[model samples]
Target chain A: MPSVKFIEHNGTEHVVDGTNGDSLMMIATSNLVPGIDADCGGECSCATCHVLVDASWVDKLAPATETEESMLDLNPDRESNSRLSCQIPMSDELDGIVINLPEFQY
Target chain B: MTNIVIIGGGQAAGQAVASLRQEGFEGKIDLIGEEPSLPYQRPPLSKAYLSGALEASKLLVRPEKFYQDRDVATHLGSPVKHISPQERTVTVGETEFSYDKLLIATGGRPRKLTLPGSDLSGIHYLRTLQDVDNIRAHMATAKNLCIVGGGYIGLEVASVAVTLGVTVNVLEMESRILQRVTTPFMSDFYHQLHTERGVHIHTETTCQGFRGQSGKVSHVLCGNQEIEADLVIVGIGIIPNIELAETAGLACDNGILVDDHCKTSDDNIFAAGDCTNHPNALLNRRLRLESVPNAMDQARTAATNMLGGDKTYATVPWFWSDQYDLKLQMLGFSQDADAAVLRGDPGTRQFAQFYLSEGKIIAVDAVNSPKEFMVAKQLHGVAVSPEDLANLDVDLKSLVPST
Candidate 1:
């Protein structure tokens, strides 16, 4: 199984195993990691499951679609590496992914 | 050690436990719910869960392990019978539990039709997981499905049932479908969309009663005409579960009245979710919204305030409804708007209805057009003319202050 690291805004870290079929939000949430709200349950509608990806691993992930971008644009704290974790599918390519969670979801 | 007790088993209950733990409360947290399972999201029940595209486990906001890992004791399958604010105690079943602070997240129940033959076996509602399971079971061999009240639940169920080869008849008491929440243009859009997909929408039709055979619903009688239906589903609206709070002497109107901080009449008790009629700081009015965003946001606020932090919930209300392939996203309420503009063409199945009050944008209904929705979200206090709104050629991102 691939592993993913979630770092909270306070610098607390939680490393969890990610399965191939589950999304990053599911992994973070199932591990009881704080900060990923997943309000819409991986529907790509609510951008609450936001994660700021590390700069080095930004291009390793798929680019966000227009719908996701539109959802993220509603967030005032969205950053350049901002992505809805629910939209990111877990795969072997994302084994050592580092994710930083925003301080507040809403 | 301090103890915190949360009532109800919906999104707010689950989020409260998570929020309390995240805030480092370290108190004895107990989440007692009427349902047998963990706190789950109800949004997908009408859409993906009804269509069997989403499973029951996926609806949970957090799994059981999270609650256990956080030392949050979950007592499921029992409803809180009484709340004694004087002692800060809640009674569930035969056991009485005391609390230092309490959260009433008791959601709402589907409003049921009290007409004749309403006790039939095949009649169903789509509120909980078991309700959908029952509806799906009835749809297995059932052909004609009569849906009462053409609201979000009724229409979303109609779209799913019709697509699954079930003949659907939607009976709305109003002159048009979704009359309460949307304009005629949006209603017409949905009417056309559902009609194209083989759904029989009967507007201005009232369901009189259900005629059944062998204690099973066979037809829905509407005034003089009776429509044959093997199964009947009612989606008129939801009555907030405020009875629990009312009996406990909390102020109740259409919903449990709460302040902007989610604080109820009692200082030791707070409320959130669909159960609370809360004041919106942004809108400058009180509203009882049945929305996931409100439930989640208010849960955070209530949790922070529970921990002695000053937090106020002033989020501009937003809601979404998924029917067929169209995702209807609405920001704020458009009822107070005097002028409305149709941004983009509805023929392309992508446009937004911008509603303005006093020549300033107040609310919007975006259909498959999320860019305009994002722009509309930031236009709460900004003043803009209707021409600026209708002009889609200009990038909507440029109209607002860039984040």
Candidate 2:
């Protein structure tokens, strides 16, 4: 059972169990995480399910696809580590992954 | 001690609960819905659910425990029969509940075409999970499927039906497919896409009546031409659910009239989603949009205003549709654009059409081009050189004037 830590903008943290093969967006949304609004329901169309991965854990995660990069590019607030959570799936090697919720899900 | 009542069970109602709790509203929340299932996304009903690729449980907008933990008293499978604005009470089924504030997120229903012999048993409208389930059951036996209206819903269903080895015939009353929502280029693009994939498209064909055998629809009579259809699905359009507001004496026109703040005629009541014709500050028009993004954004704004916050929902409207291997994403809507610019060749299966008015990007239609769609949302209403937009060498990011 892998786990993911979601840190809100206000410094509050939520550690929830993540099942293997489910996207990070599904895990955060299923657990009622407040900040990540997966409005498109895992469709890469809407970039609302945005999260900035922890700098230490950034390289450990799968790289964002070209489509995801294009979607993330237009955002004025997008950081270098910013990725749509829906594009990342959970895995055993990525256990205890730490991700930060952006101030707004634009 | 505060009581907030939300009427509707779609994404708007579901998101309203999340928004309310996140905004720190420590009060009683009641959500009354006509559907038995919790709030779910309707987009998948046409694509995945119809093709048996996705299950029924996956359609929910949020998990069930999310609402239960927040203590949202959801009255599923029951409609709000009456709303008394003066008393701030809504009658759900047999129970009467008083509210300090109320939200009418009652979305909309499919607009049915009433022609001769339309009461046939095989006729259906793609709106709910039950509708898709029933249609899927028919698809198992249906050989010739006829889809009325060549809009997004109709074309999406056609793609699925054709993929399932069922012969699909799309009948559109308009001169071209997707005429109501898109420009000629994109409509023609979809027309070619569907035809190339083995779909029979009948444009400018008006269905006059339906004829059935054994009480099930078997044929569609279009003027002098008759279309033989073993199964029929109508995707014409939708009618907003504004009867409650109208009965309660709220202002109504094309839809329940609301301001950018999602406030109705009565300050105590707010309306969101497809049911309300809200004014968009960016578009500067009062329009009723039937997109999931619009519904969620408006619901959040209404929740904030209901909790005494002064937030407004004026975000640029955007929508997406999937059919076969193509994904169409659109931002903004204007059919009366004086200038339409094309970026990339449509024959390449990846292109974008920009609709400009007064030299500003008013609307855009992007097919299989996510990069253009993403840039279009940020540059909505911004004036750009049409030459720069048509030039492929210049990066679209550069065209987006640096703020």
Please provide, for model 1 over A4-92, each residue's C-alpha lDDT reduced to its tens digit, 9 standing for 90 to 100. Answer: 99999999989898879688998897776888887767888767798999898899988998899888876777899999999899999
Q: Under CAPRI classification, how is model 2 graded?
A: medium
Residue B131 error for model 2, in Å? 0.6
> Which regions of candidate 2 fall more than 4 Å away from where they truly are?
A30-32, B401-403
Question: Which ten contiguous residues of candidate 1 chain B have the minimum total lDDT?
Answer: B394-403
Model 1: colliding residue pairs: none
Can you give the lDDT of residue B238 in candidate 2? 97
What do the candidate models score in CA lDDT, each in turn?
0.88, 0.89
lDDT at residue B374 of model 1 (Cα atoms): 70
**What's the CA error at residue B239 for candidate 1, in Å?**
1.0
DockQ of each: 0.55, 0.63
lDDT of 1 by residue, B1-403 (tens): 3999999999998888888888889989989999888998898898999899988877888777788878899999988889999988999888999998999999999988898999999999878988988988888898999999989888999989999999999999999999998888789999999999999999989999999999999999998899999999999898999988999999999899999899999998999999999998788889999888899888989999988889989988888889988888888788888889989999898899998888888888999887677777778757786787788776676677755
* Candidate 2 residue B122 C-alpha distance from true site, Å: 1.3
